[model samples]
Target chain A: MTTSPTERNGWSGDGALTDMAASVPKAARKTSRLAGPASTAEQWPEFEAVAQPQLQGAAVRRLAGRRSNNGVGSSNSSSSANIGNNPSKRRWPRVVLIVAAALVVVALLLVAFAACSISRGESSFEGLMANAVIETGANAVSYDEGKTVYYNGHTYVLNEDMVSVLVIGIDRKESAAEDKPVQADAVIVVALDKKTGQATAISIPRDSMVEIGRYADGGYAGVETAQLCLSYGYGDGYETSCEYTTTAVSRTLYNMPINYYFTMDQAGIGPMNDAIGGVTLTPLQTIPKTQIVEGQETTLLGTDAYNYLRWRDKTVLTSSLDRQDRQIQYVKAFAKKTLGAAKSDPGLALSLYNQVSSYSITNMGMDEFSYLASVVMGGNITGLDVISLPGEMVQGEKYAEFYLDKTAVYETILDVYYTQVD
Target chain B: MTSEQPPTTSNPDPKVPVVRKYRRTIAALTVLLVVLLLSASGGIGWLIWEHNQREKAAQELAETPIPTVEQPVASTPDTPEVALPDNPIDFASIQQTSPDVYAWIYIPGTPINYPVVQHPNDDFFYIDHNPERNYAFEGSIFTEMANSLDFSDPITVIYGHNMHDETMFSTLHYFEDADFFAENDEMIIYTPGHILTYRIISAYQYDNRHILNSYDFSNPEVLADYQEYVRNPDSLLVNTRDVPLTSTDKIVQLSTCMTVQNWNRYLVNGVLIDDHLTN
Candidate 1:
């Protein structure tokens, strides 16, 4: 095929041809490859399909080839085929980029999955397991009964896992000498059941006759059966005093072991009560007004509370046992308040612990304090059974004394300290 | 047959499979690197968190007020007073928190100062429970309910886990060394009204036995015979100090798991040399 000279010259002239050539530059027209044939109009669509990216360059070269005045439609059609199927086409780069992005997304998903699986549960504190409870009795006997109990003889025998705490409020007006036994004003034993959160608080009257190991001038003078409260007077310091008091209480209570003891003086008692923001008292009976009112809902500050605790108005409620009832009520309320306060601010227990350091003494460690605080906060405190040894008030050589109802006290302790489970 | 000499500057044509192999190798390396990087970061982060938690607990314990439970009086009647922890806490309040608090056991040289509680009827519960009364792998130091709470028994055995972290009875192993037993021999047991002191006399490895359950300590003859056995123990027993073992001297045994056998336990025996009533 060939193009007529007139036709080729006219299409390739400096003057624009028909409509398409008008936009073409003079240099482009001279170099145009499409100029090889007058049939370019018929093949224009095919060339445009593959030459879009190098449109201007390919168009100029195509036109220039035909500008030689030769007709070649077959050649132009074949050129478009090769360019369309070329592997180096810009399309390959887009495919490569897509593959890289997909790889990155998959890696990120793997990382996320690993992270989710590796994260630990919020409640999982492995250290707590070492410092706390060991789940036992599950594989041992009495699976139906809780771990803290053993079913024996139709009654759940509490493992003498019994934690008996003796609480003492000392009546020493001045610093006691090493050998002087200062009597405790109030003595109470709070026994807790390890299995069930039952607490039995038994208060011993001051005048009950029980053998207390006497400490004389830095030496123990064997056992002397004296007023129960006089046990505190056997030792000059806190240790001896507390020990004798504890021993006396133990002896009076059927020799039940007292696990730990706490002694507080008037100063410590008041501050400790106030530390928990004062305890509210509601008197059940009418009495004379003093630092704390008798019948109304009166809040006692530390000092006022202390005065109320030790107040033994001989005229009204002549027995010291009457003072015990008041002490029991005050202790319960104070414990509740302290626990509630500690729940909000655990530091409160520590602060109170420090406050009582100088004037008070106890065998309890902070580990014990923290555990008690948690138990109180957890509301496990149940069976706040408060009782005193059933006794008769009698006259002594100098002061009035109370004779403990021994059989009754024994029965009460057995009931309060142990419960039957079938 | 189809090929003429290729360009000298170029090498052989890479097959489709070969190109694919190179791409796979690069991806695998990238994946491995990412995993390693993540593991290093996560592991280091966890370690820091754990250390911080332990530090906080140690600080709190150090500051926990130590009551003047141990009297300042020296060992002898006329000896000078020594500095002692004097802060006392209300045990009733503590029992409120943890009913497990049965007694406070303290040994001066080791981390044995802790609240001891008997497992409810189960001598083995402390093998799993912590001081918080929670099931833990490193259990708390505990005693069986068979023992008298007043320390009146001829033989009372306390148990703890042999944790590698040197917690609980793990430190009790120090008694196996004769010098450790001699230098730090005193073991103080505190109750509501008493400060009882014991001197470490013997330590050795022993097998598991329901000790108090196995024998009756109530009989005077049985109690006397057992004291003889403890005084003249097996060849493995290391006797650090010799004090006359009488029927009256109550002995407290500290036991922990031993590595020699699963059923083997290391025991430290202390004789009640002094039973003083400290208020």
Candidate 2:
């Protein structure tokens, strides 16, 4: 069994044969360990088979008493085995790293998609809600009903186009005995021209004398003439007040048939003001007094504007005409602010429309409201034309009674409403 | 024993070879870290720049001023002034003139001297025609020769539109109640020959019909009815103690359209009390 000197020299001539023989045994043993626990002891036998040649050569060298080269070679061989085994053990971490990286990317993409959808939805919802509210609220009133009335022996149709719509603001008290709502402290008429998109605004003093619908006692016959038409409307129904007041006013001077009507209580005005941001109008004078009436003061910026329109009983103002002037100022200021805001801020308009929808009632439908707003936005009517019926034109009782200036009123109406536009 | 010993003559080698590998692994990790950091920094810088641009545009729009209507452009004068009487009553000289003849109205206490041109068409006089001239400024006043204060009879009703600019009869709106009217009760109207001071007596809104028919210049009963109606004791601005109107008291009515339709016309009626001829 001992190797000859010639055979030994042959083994030394090529080291690949020795290295392969060493690796084959270790590879077979590792594979057997991975396969199962059953042939564990047999693995050593297989390993020994592969290592026998190299071991035999080493033993031959050892017999010759050489140690350092064998030690280093064995160390190198073992290290190579360790490096090879490391990649298999590291496999799990590599798979974990790849999966984690893929998950992070997917999560980021999901967040981005969610954010974009939310932003788009918010803007779209805002616009849709605004349009809905405006349309719904504006449909409450009828803007197109035509009523015919006689004035100065001539009959005229009071259509939305030719008639004046008086918006009355009434200050109501919680405790005050609820007679019909209090007299209109403030009155403004928007005389619209359907054909031309032109409108005239008239502010009436509450103290103006005019024939009102007959109330219980304060009257001559069935006629009660006074400036406070709201008192009549409140005491009587809208139709009766319209007839008595319109008839009296028509007979007095150049009055025209009445058209649309809007009544806003004090509570309604506040929200409308807030919805439109605020009305901006020039004040006629620096009002020293804060409160126009007891418990009613123009402290806030919005309320202050309201006060100018509502102030009716103070001696500081020489006459009702002065109050009328203040009312006109408020109208112009409100118109400018409302129209301007609608043009610039769509979100703000939506918010305002929503707010106004809750409190305001208008006869105009969605189409008419949109049309009216568009006309104003188009800049057709920039300046407001204000006029009043002449005193000499009206006739009635001294205190609360009054009449109309028929000629002047008709002429004014014709000029404002009927004149053909080129 | 001799045979077994002969079969086990060769011995096996046990030393193992080890190789250390560091260059490739270190290089891969370093490259991945650098790529992640670079991507994060670039994304953050882009977002900050977009936010600043939107803020700058909003501030500039808030500072612009609104333009006014009725500003007078260069144009020839419309209404020719009639020659004054030989006595030549000099109310203050015309402060400014409008290109159109529409009318010239003067009030002593306020700054309302402007050309009164018809609004839209030449049918009704409105102050909107001349922008340089505002009839509602303080110290400007308006007077119409045709209107009187007492609503009793066929009266010439002078009208002035109330304006937000405080130019025309804007101040008049303050007089509807008692206190505001008391503070500014007396306003003098200056015609070419006579300076007339009017005492504000009554202020109220009348039915539109009443305003239309009350201007019958020929009927005395109509004027009487107008006067009686305004003299009500319960008036918010006027009390019974105010003297009854006499023939000497000519009326001046200042009027403006109310925002309200058909309900009423905002009316300010004043009686002419003192007259002075200024030459």
Candidate 3:
């Protein structure tokens, strides 16, 4: 089983020594004998001198290791030559190299996977709005109005373009029901031109004189002509009050027909604000009445902005007209913030739409409203003109009266409503 | 070789000593080689498995999708069949479900589709809960929950509720940082066809009631005075470029409640830039 030393080191009896010796230069052939076993001091110099050249040459050759040769060798040239002929030993290094390469490939793939997972978790505006809509229960309103309003012996079909909308701000403090009739704190008249997509808004002062629409119910029938419009009616029936009020106001002030109405109460504001995140508003002066109200507390995500708006008494407002102007300020502020927020986050916009739809009573259907939304969203309209009704106190024998300045109101409306666009 | 030796017990296997030494050396070398080979193979295998895991994780990460940023539209289409009339207001088309609970505001630049909830109890809109039955789009605008349009005082304060989705005035922070405001200065507001363009004169974030007297908008003189105060250089987010504001100017004030402090208000001041009709 065991071969002689010569056979073990080399494949043949001649081994690789004879061949290596022959390959050496003739002058260096003497160095071969010097490599022989001779442990003696006197022979050391001779052996070193002769063997130095051959040893140096062998070292250089070994340093230039080629991957194909596997570079497995010893100082003994015979043994190296014999081992180099064996193909099985050479294949060992190739297996190791292949395994290393496979490991590298696997590592790269895992890295790629981890990177993808991290990127997917980021959230955006549109998604947030979608979630918000689900959270705030707002639905689309249908646009089917069974009847049309007759104006000047001509029936006016209820459409988005040629509609007059009355935007009412109601003060609903006592009743918890969403449909309860609340007193109107603010009133705005909006007329839309369907063909042009142009709108005219006229702010109606709360103190203006007008005959309340006679209702079968005792609540609004006897209300004073000067009281706010919402102090008299509720729900679908409120349309009559809007019709009568629109007629009287139009005749008494702008001499125009009123068509549509939109009413909002206290319950719906929070979600709308939450939907857009929040709106930014700049005040003309500093308001100091910052008391926390009942049922309203500050949270990490929610803050009480209503108290700031309600801080009227402490703000040194000189007149009711001043308060009306402040209301306009709030509206403009809301407009800028909401529009800007919607641009970045569609989900928030959708959420706000959903929330508002729930508590609102509007004549516009979902489809018609979407068209209007597209126009507003697509075009820029930050410079819209806003005008308020003119009013003055009238001295009477029995009661002090506030009368609407008909000429001023009409002039303001005409200017806003009759603009030519190029 | 045939020398006569002392008669001692002689064993036939006399070469056993040399054979035993050689065998021991060979066995030790074999053991070392085998152990080295086993360890190397195991090391390579572990490295390969680890690398594969990492690659898989990276691949999964690459496959994830990022959310889109824009306004949302109604799933249904808006066509002429559902259109409202051209003249006289259509009361029936615009339903008032909760009178005073919510109202619809149409701004030309806004993506609001449905009626927005009117938060009478609070001055601003709630970003979390949707006002039931209202147009609860993600970024629908909300007005001051309780502020009035009183122009009699020095400043008329209006407040809007901000949302995390950046729907309302979440972008208002862009103004708080100086560089952002420089690029954006104009916005358009639409009420039906009444278009109003506003110019951002200055923007500032303040603690709630920092300038207490400026919220009154009733007095024209007071309003002018409040504008001056807001234009002061010391304000947190204001530009003191001497932007002129007058009583004749119909200014728009936008306010939002912030979580910075319990009562802190973040206000964005803008002036009426211009007004024009689209159609």
Candidate 4:
């Protein structure tokens, strides 16, 4: 082939043709290889059909030769093949364009797929509600069931979007005897409405009589109506105790759902109190038995907050109730200070939660804490109302029993949980 | 045996012939690139159109006026049941759209106003079908055959999609906020001749267990246990009231999907607190 080009062009030597082939700038060589012959239109088809495959083969060999040269700096005989590989370079950009376009299509598909998945999940939600008419042998009300309850000639619905949690203050610490059952010193049901920023705490005196399941050796014993504090004594003094107490409170409070329990021993009060600097308030009453003086303005530190909560005169039958009033006062002040600090420092709530965790056991997770914190902080809550359950402390044979007023319980449940439906 | 290259120093022929030879191949490659380029843009356009369709459906439903039930004449005072005020609603128009639609639900302070339907044959038919019975991404608010159309069951569970567009029950998440739950506590369900108002008791995340299938509401003990679970759910994200839920109390549980956890559903439970006779 090299000799034929020299003879046809009337060149004197074969070296001249090789030099000319090599000297054709790489871009020109791309076309020159295919340009040979075809001076006449009649020969063009014949030349193209036979030349396409050979040109492709030459391009492929040239690439291999170039790669080898880079790797081993080897001298190869395929130098002439390299001159015809300009077409490969011209096609590189097109290949990249196709790939980029395909990627764009794929990315759009992924986004659309994500959006459809959300709708798909929502549409796939299946519900379980049975229409089977089964007679439960109970008298049916004359009006629409479940939607409205007629109470005292008034119709009311459960207030929308209300949240309630049971805050239990234990009488004993973790170091106490494992076998011995402990009492819940303070039982409070705190309800919060994030929208209204309205929060109320219903304090259940430890001695309130309620039905609680009695557990013996982790087995369920028969339920007994006893002082509410005794419910804590029925369990292993941890989760079981809280569960028992929650059931008792729920039953006593007209079966109100009291989820979210946070049980803390008496020892947690100090660290909790000190976490927000300290709680300052005027003493509500004089307690001669302890350092808490009546009608005196005081800022309580760690142990001071502990004394304000723990000291109850054993002589008086109503001493626990009196202590409860002061405990409510202290809690209100402490919470006010803590939440106020939390408004400025978002981490304050978590830090306070962590500080009390050593002496506390709770079903609340970090999400719950953050949820409540955000609610309390973002809500327009003026202050938390500390309410004492209206009850009469009666002298029993050996211990004092606080019997909650049924009407009061009903009224409280209505005021806190129900909205008038007119 | 054909090729001869001209000397680089004195090249006589022009390059135009070479370019002319490959013109058809270049044209084919150009066509392919254009097709690929068009497909990429077309894919994006299809997605936008799909999203617009979903939004259009939602917007149409939102624009539909909630029909009001006309109040009947004075009833017996001894009955302790009062008649509601006349709110004229062309319920006939609503029924015309779908005979399956039996009730209307309205929650103030949230975008939950919509007609409630029950597919007689398939419990899940309305899940992906609109009130017009057309296929829609945002399904209609529906109930299964497990519940009566009159809302008389001890527990009536209503199902809706938690659409990302916040058109369906997605706004139910408002109740997750304490302030929203407290301020907006009542929801109204209007049947043919009666207006029912339910008191929102609690808004909490619950397991995806079918309430009707999981418990026999016909059994008083089972109903009591289920009611207890409703009042005192084990979920961490919860907002509850001090309201009591008894086995005799007829409650409506609005169920939707949770955003974070697919296996769990967010429930806004309401107990029947008010019922008014309407024409």
Interface RMSD of each: 39.7, 43.9, 38.0, 32.7
TM-score of 1: 0.39
Candidate 2 per-residue C-alpha lDDT over B1-279 given as tens digits, one digit per residue, 9 for 90 to 100: 011111111122222221222223323433543454355344444434433432332232223222112322344467354332221222133224432223333443344343333232322222222322433112112223233322233343544444323345444444443444555566554444445566767766443222333234355665566666655422212322264875435666666533322123456666777765433
TM-score of each: 0.39, 0.33, 0.32, 0.44
Ranking by DockQ: 4, 1, 2, 3
Highest lDDT model number: 4
Candidate 1 retains true contacts at a fraction of: 0.00
Docking class of 1: incorrect
Residue-level lDDT for A178 in candidate 3: 59
Candidate 3 matches the true fold with a TM-score of 0.32
For candidate 1, write residues A300-334 as lDDT tens digits: 88567876777776754345777888888887887
Off by over 4 Å in 1: A1-156, A174-181, A284-291, A314-317, A382-384, B1-279
* Backbone clash numbers for all candidates listed: 58, 151, 185, 28
For model 2, the interface Cα RMSD in angstroms equals 43.9
Error of 2 at A302 (Å): 3.1
Worst 10 residues of 3 chain B by lDDT: B1-10
